[model samples]
Target: MSDRYELVLTCPKSLEGLLAEEAAGLGLAEVRAQVAAVQGLGDLETAYRLCLWSRLANRVLLVLGRFPVGNPEELYQGVQAVDWQEHLLPTGSLAVEFSGHGSGIDNTHFGALKVKDAIVDQLRRDSGQRPSVDKLSPDLRVHLRLDRGEAVLSLDLSGHSLHQRGYRLQQGAAPLKENLAAAILIRAGWPRIAAAGGALADPMCGVGTFLVEAGMMAADIAPNLRREQWGFSRWLGHVPALWTRLHGEAEARAAAGLSREPLWIRGYEADPRLIQPARNNLERAGLDAWVRIYQGELATFAPHPDKGQQGLVVCNPPYGERLGDPASLLYLYQHLGERLRSQCEGWEAAVFTGAPELGKRMGIRSHKQYALWNGALPCKLLLFKVVPEQFVTGRNEPAPSQARMIGGQLVERPPAVRTEPARLSEGGQMFANRLQKNLKQLGKWARREGIECYRLYDADMPEYALAVDLYRDWVHVQEYAPPRSIDPEKAQARLLDALAAIPQALDIDPSRVVIKRRERQAGKKQYERQDQQGRFMEVSEGGVKLLVNLTDYLDTGLFLDHRPLRLRIQKEAAGKRFLNLYCYTATATVHAAKGGARSTTSVDLSKTYLDWARRNLALNGFSEKHRLAQGDVMEWLEADRGEYELIFIDPPTFSNSKRMEGVFDVQRDHVRLLDLAMARLAKGGVLYFSNNFRKFQLDPALEQRYAVGEISAQSVDADFARNPKIHRAWRLQALQG
Candidate 1:
């Protein structure tokens, strides 16, 4: 083998430039960027150095030979012509990775097998002992790239992808790969920031990928130093002395960097389970002391006060993959932008998201956007300098101060009232006064009961037909379609008044208020999406976290009126097998799981709601034993063979989903639905059936077979006290013969 051979360092396609720059910086001669790789001329020492230090490289390869091949026969001959003995011992293990396909090589597995056979046959003929194949931890890893009847073969010198870094023992869902994380940091100018001694933070960091990567780059620590194995470590041409020298130099640099001033790198995750994994990864990377991982929600995220004033704030927020509609993700992006604008002034921000449209909702224009790929998903990295002048609003404004504490509510002076004059008609003024009165009354009750989500006003006035629901600090308004007798312009003006009054009276940002129309539905119209904004917000109820999408549908996913019923189920769910049928969003099931139910099964017809149900369960730390099934609830009930100790059935008043065989009317089908559910209930099990059909009546036949008692009065909470007819509930049990 030549002392200086052509080498190729591979990375994700969009990171070619970064890889090339890194390779050139490492002193590799003739460095050139390819489609998804960087090619250069380097000896064994250079290859070893890259394997130890290159953070953005997937693998380092030593190009062996290239040849034109039109068929497997030619492929075999081309691979066999190479001197395999020079790279691997005759008895050593080997693995072949084949990419691309052409000329009878349609199957990657078949191509790989052919290459392996050629190598084994040539080695056996030359040394009488052929190497075995070890796909995992192979002594020699061979890579073959076949493109349009041409083949290039190389010896994989990195063994596994360098992204492993040998420190991530656990990861959250949809984690950013290590190399991708490194690429994002480099693009965000993390290196320059670190050199200047600025701080870094990832508020939505999952397992601290960005934090750990940034810490390594800041400390000049080798990326792969923690790895115990490398492909070149067992190669016959390996040079131990040169490798040792580069390793010692990297170690000395790391030691010196560590002894200097610490880099203030921090990661905050809402899921506490994820915090430990990040801590473990940082510890394994020898950066535990330099990085801090905290458990906090994004709304409460702020830069550490002791850290420097400016740095990089980066995050890879969820992109509505398993969570369902993309419309629900807009709120997250909006909140992220708000947080960066309000708290991260003077810092640079980089947001990596698969959904670019959601990024636009942030209201902060990006100075730069780079098209990147997170595995197979197309993504964009939005770069921003968090400056006050760049923000569309809330810039140069001081944080709101507590003006007065009414009924335990700290009313902050709203920014809107300061900038714009309050405009209201005589009727609008009356509506605004009613809203304030309701807030004072219900807000006190909500605080006393620890209810973060509750209805403050439900169309109390005739002129202003709207329902105002409070979700923690945010407010959601639902406008009832006005009567046709009223003038359209007049009704619209009144609605504008209510919308204008809500933010000012509640002391909340207007941006936090979402408005939607509620009308009597005909069929599946209510379930159809009104928009594709995909914005979801987390809200709490009785200590359980649930997601609500205020802009996507007619409802906010949670039925504030059902809060009492959910709490009742939770209190009665201990040591019971709980079932939630027609479980829209499964908030009740989440309550049951939190209440120590042995197991919980949530069944819903819509795939969207099932995804929402899964998220709700995960948010509360429920195990996989809490199952969510998507299917027609009636069909599911007929198919279920397991018995449940407790069941909650709260079907929609009416639904005509395409997935269902027939339309469902709760008033007409309540008996059949309840019968099917009760048949699966264990003897003496309690079944709570509830519906929102204002005039619903229990069938006389159901009363004959079960001991039924009305519990509507007990099931309604203080928030829904004024609207007792909002929903009705009943307790049913099998009657002894």
Candidate 2:
């Protein structure tokens, strides 16, 4: 009767039903919810209204046609059958978004190109002109989905997604999308709470997304009122008068609602830099007068006294996805629970987090939890009412299943508890006692020296053949493979004893301990991954940050034995060009760059290590003037033409990597490697050569051409004092004529 057409409203997967309900309320006929989308019959006015008002919908698509196809040619012909003149002028620009796979459309980019070609060809043959593609923003956006040899074509009527509400000009790290934030509020019953004259607060608000959305919902403001444009604005079938009428009515309702007594909407952020941005965003949303933002810490957060009680307190806290440590986030969550319990007695709180295990650390029971998705990550929205019983106080005893929290302090829980006194074997007791003595001695020194990462135990006991390294709160245990002469069962027993005693003696959580076996490596074996977790932890050495993958590679990326050498390099690298050969993870290069080195060149055979080197440099704020090269060190030494004032060369003891042109035995090839590296050195340059070959002997010929001095004693740090044979070093300089 009124030019009826099929329409599809797309939203996030979990919000399809909500979107369908909204569309039905908008008077769209025959509304039905489907997977990730809603379908209905709607004319021009209905489409325009839905485009302007549906907050949950990502896109309002007008179903153009559906066809079956089994090949790329059929797909092209199917798209070409559409009438191009009805959607856009020949000069109008457009973009196609292709998705799914099958029927010869193997790639999204190739499918999109085919669709564009079909459109351009049709327009050119019909009107002698073709529209160009605009990727950023186009007059028309075409969406093509291919599934099981069928193609569904539609026109996207909502451009740039409805989540871009045009209010936020600034954002904190890992900001939540506006639509997801709205869904959180809806799930938490914020709209009903606001209707009853209740207030809202987000103590950890990042750029005020939830607060603005809440303010709009409370004031009856349209979410898209401030948006600059919509896809339907340029569509040929758009009804301008209908859109104008709906927009005017929304404006009148918003004005009337704003005239009422303002609701109390507030946000607080600990970062002072974000306060101004949050305020600016509020002003852009025209909610500056209605909402308030304050710079305050979460520990001291409280609702305004003038506002009503019994509202919603919502926040999307850091989940350690992109930043922060998951282990350390436990304290933040515990503190949040404490504050909410002590300060917000009657308020309801909702915490949206990707890490549910950390949420348990809150020590507060949740009344309800809604499964949600934050983009592709599965997450949960935990809702709880602030009651006195939900707050556990003065319970110093650790929960049986939870980590120990004693005297308001985070302490490691024992791995297991027994009523009878636990007994250790003679060798196991000796290993345990040795770990305790080392902790007392090295722990004092490490704290005094401000070193967060250091070797604690390095095979001090003959039976306990393991190297235990402390990385901040975590410990990395590497078990040196026992000789075949030893009984396999006996060796495994000793290894298990050492692992058990580590946490007990060091007071570390067993979950924080990572165990690996070290043996003779060959042909990229050292670089090969034993696990595919891809988990990286940030640790500090010499006041510089580095990423270490404990679960992935055999090596931890940072060598604890080279601490003093790195320190020496940093001290002497100021304003000089530094070069690092066989720079595994480039720890020395990071130290040099941090010490104001003029520039640096790091060479390694593995791209994995080079990428790690780049991350270490970037983590230390050293991005420019640093070059990382991936090639065999032998080949690179021969080819490098640039001169360096300071060079550090540390070669593996023996490597037969496939990437290398030939096998490299450092003991046999030391002289040749040093000669080539020294040739690229400036006249006054200093070359520091190091290796872990216990029986390495310096070539006398090197002393005949240069001033060579062994600095092994001076280079060994206190942590590796007992293991002096761990490495050897020599400082060489060009002989003065």
Candidate 3:
């Protein structure tokens, strides 16, 4: 018999069983699933096919040798015993990836070094042209695993982590690897669904990993069809013709699948920033025509497939370290469950989350749970059949009961579709009462001004200490961090009472309400990481749509208190150059642009804010002649030569951002900040300076140097009149010469 080489297919932990099943299906013999790997006996051709087709594997290793290793010396000697000449040229390059820890080789770096030294030293010749080390695209890649006191050495036939499928170069902050996504799809029974011409959808499809992986499987396309490089490409034993034939067959199968009608696969993402990148990834995978992506919110995620066609609803929602509020994350999962029960009846739903507690709170009973790993974090894949009976539907619903079959008989029952209302505490009733009263008062004012977002209540009761804001129908509840004097448990209890009172008090779905505790964070930490989920909301302000990320940022993009100021800028922006300094999301610049400003430039130190500003501008068709500068406003002003006819400066109360050259206190730096801005003030130009510092005092020198008028009262709208200290504003103009 020809050499029956050992084949080891590695995968994410808990995926070895699936990998083994796949290997057996692909005609590998004696396949057995082991820890984090599946080993089998296969010929070189079977190994090549496995590299090209195994969707669950991270690497396909061809075992070249195995030997006992008592210490570091034996580890090196074990690798040196292999005939390196047969696999690599004397002048070629090699890389070693060492794993496991034993036999005094606990450090992976040192272990890899030993393996590399052994290979290179064994290949050493008199010509002094020995093999060099190449981490990427090496002539040959060696992998060694130290198990107990033994070592198993192999050659890596798959390069660059097969998870890098060459399609998703751009991804969200916490994107799943392609192989993991594929395994998830398989666990969700996507193959059976796709064969029956069923549809697939992911409500929170970050970079469209699920949608693309599902599409590739449904389209009969090899997961690595587009990958150009492989570890075996440079191997001496690689059969070029055999590989070419396999590749050509994959291409033919892909073309034949593409010639048929495309499957109905779709992905929805709440973040606008990820939409284009997701689409680009789909395009790169050659699945853009088969898969479609849309900008959608999880709260409003309604999966609509072709008529009578229902398949899998798969999503890997953000959880654990990825999100801040456990309560808010519960509502996210609840939304997924609610959408499934109300919309996608008769479908299968798979939710992959690191926090199984959050998954349990989805209010759906999962028939099965699979243990999986996303990196080092232990996660679970909760699989549910989205029938009416599976929905838990209430806080006090009974735990799901297994179907009872007695004496070869089956009991018939209707789907137990029930929903118990969320209970409210005695204190919650008073909180709800206050919310209703405030809503009655502000409802008309909000409607008359065409306001879709406005503050409804701001700690009306000392016990609540919550600010309730209405964004269209969705309610954003921000509970100010409780005082140290207050009991922590009591504060949390009150917050929970307020949350329970919100949806009912506002006449909206509970999923529409998201609660976050507003703790006093350090400088710029709140704005540091945009919620990875991209919870961006587009609300209308001043007759122009502005993107406000209520889920992520501490301050909504539109500062409702500054409505009058933005309106003032908009009123006077016609045919004039408008500048917005420290423009958080460039809301004022958008107003200026919408009001037909000749040009608008916004400056800020946060790249995140600038990106938000760009999206806000694009949302309102305000891209032309508008510039978003990412730098300290002071530095931007000092280097500026252009003059603006209208300027709006809204500085922070205190900023010690590392991005800035020095600390900025509104009280101390207002004069210098304005002087630089004032120098760029064209003759007859108006500059509006504003800050949230309650103790702000405009320098006496500024009044002497320019005409100053305090418009703080005018800038505060009726909604903000309750707290005029929300911000202070002043209009400054160059004195007529």
Candidate 4:
């Protein structure tokens, strides 16, 4: 066998350049970086060095042979041509990994199988015994690449990926991979900091992945030093003396590095559960003496290293992929930036996050950003210099305090009121002035009535057609789709102006404002999801907690305009069987339960909405006794035999859901829907029916069957008094004879 070899190093796609630089430093020659890999030439010792040293590489491949393949027979012939006896014994085990496909080999699995069969058949003919396939571990691992009808086969030299590191047996919900963590630290210039004898801290460390990786890198420790298994460990061509010599040198270097005075490394985790695991990881890496971990929170995050020491503050905060919404995470990032600026004024910082938009909200400008991948998701490594001038928000002021809720009542606003934003135009200033005037008038009543969510403004001006509503501290803005006659550019400019004026005028952060376009809907389009963020927050209405997701659907789970109706349902539902039909999120059912209803049944056509309703019910101590049924409301009403004394129906204007038998229009189907609903209404019980269709007309024939009286005037609340046409309501009951 030749002492020299051609090698390939593969990494995450965007890390090829970094990998090339690393391989060159590890004594490889002719290093050339490709899309997701680097190619180079190296001797056996150089290849072994790369395996033990590379932090960005996922695998290392030592080329065995390269040949042109045109068909399956050629593929088999080429593989069989290689002397398999040189790599593995006839009684040993092997694993084959194949990638890319062509030349009549359409499936990667089939190609891999073919290669395995060729090697096994060749060995069987020679010794009457064949090697078995062991995917997890084997005497040999082979990788075949077919590109443009050419095949290149190689033996994996790194065995399992070098990222395992053997220290992280327990991790948080979403921990960064060890190799990816190393790549991030390198890009953030952690090596330079450590060489200068500086400190490193992670305020949001989870299971100490970052802390352990950073500690190992700073101490000049080989990442895979603890690995016991390797692809070449049992290979037939293995050089035991050469491997032993290299391993001994690495051991000497590590011992010398670890014996010296340690660097200042610390990690803080909010979860106490993660603190022990993080310490375990540090201890396992033999780095427990060098690094320290404490249970702490973001608001009080502080790293008080030696007075003269300065270093990098690194963290991988939650990116809203699994936990909170992107909007909710805004406060976390903003607070992180604040901490860095206030506490570590002269230190550097690096934030690795999948949500760059949230990163932009940090109020500090990033000097550099590197693209990286977290598994399949693309992410950004944001680098910043913690200097006073780098702050984007020039105002060195604390965030505005949020409104508090006590027993679902709007308690009080801050004593300080903010004026209009100086950036607003003449029209925008006027809009802002009007909103303030309305808030002053509506604020007093909302506080007294314990209404935490209400409409602050509703297109009171012709220039800006928008609806602004407040759900506790959050503001939901909906721009009414302007008529075609209006100029689109002018409309957009006015909308931007409106958005700018909101934060200053309302005394809330820009992150709390959610904007959406409002337009008419046909068929099931109205019920269609606008976005799929799945972010939900709880808001109180009449002292009851209800969940509202502003990002996921066109309408929030709770309707502000229907506040009075929900309140009315709670008042009359005591000791009665209450039924809520077309219950979008079962907000009304929650009210009825809190109002002392003996039993409650909610019916809706959407399983999604029903699931949401289940959560809403569960949020308020309600259980299976408060039933939530999934099916067509019409069909369910026809099948339901239980009688309800109090019934509320607030349905869509039109629906053509596939789950239903036929299309439904409130104008055309109200009579049939009401008849079915009224059948189950017990004597002396009242049914409340409501809709939002402005053109809807109630049938005159319904008055002859029962007592039907319009209750639209009483249903309109103070917040929606200007838009009386928002909804129409009626009270229907059995005739008293």
Please report, as a residue range, the 10-residue window in candidate 3 with the lowest summed lDDT. Answer: 413-422
Per-residue lDDT over 288-386 for candidate 3, one digit per residue giving the tens place of the 0 to 100 score: 899999998886676666676888999998874533365566557766777777667799999999877656556678999999999999999999998
Q: For every model shown, what is its TM-score relative to the native structure? A: 0.63, 0.60, 0.62, 0.78
Put the candidates in TM-score order, highest first.
4, 1, 3, 2
What TM-score does candidate 4 get on C-alpha atoms?
0.78
Better of 1 and 2 by TM-score: 1
lDDT over C-alpha atoms for residue 372 of model 2: 85
TM-score of 2: 0.60
Of candidate 4, the 10-residue stretch with the lowest lDDT total is 414-423
Point out where model 1 deviates above 4 Å: 305-309, 321-328, 399-737
In candidate 4, the residue pairs with backbone N, CA or C atoms under 3 Å apart (3 or more residues apart, or in different chains) clash, namely: none
Which ten residues in a row are the worst by lDDT in model 2? 414-423
- lDDT order, best first, reads 4, 1, 3, 2
lDDT-superior candidate, 2 or 3 = 3
Best by lDDT: 4
Clashing pairs in 3: none
- C-alpha-based local distance difference test score of model 1: 0.86
Q: How far off is residue 412 in model 4, in Å?
A: 36
**How do the residues 1-737 of candidate 2 rate in per-residue lDDT, one tens digit apiece?**
23887898888878877788789988689999988889999887788778777778888888888999798899899999999889889999999999989987799999999999999999999999999999878888999989888899999988888888899989988888888888899889998999999989899997999999899989999888877688877877667788889899989988987888989888999999999999999999888999999989887786754844568899998876321143235446666776676567788999999876555546567889988888888999999888756644332232365467799998875333111112344676789899899889988999999898889899998888999889998888888889989997678668756765666677776567777777878668877767677888898877889898876677889988888999999999999999999999999999999888999999999998999999999999998999999999989888879999999999888889988888998888999999999999998999999988788898898899899999999988788888999999999999999
lDDT of 1 at 41: 94
Whole-model Cα lDDT of every candidate shown, in order = 0.86, 0.84, 0.85, 0.87
Backbone clash total for model 3 is 0
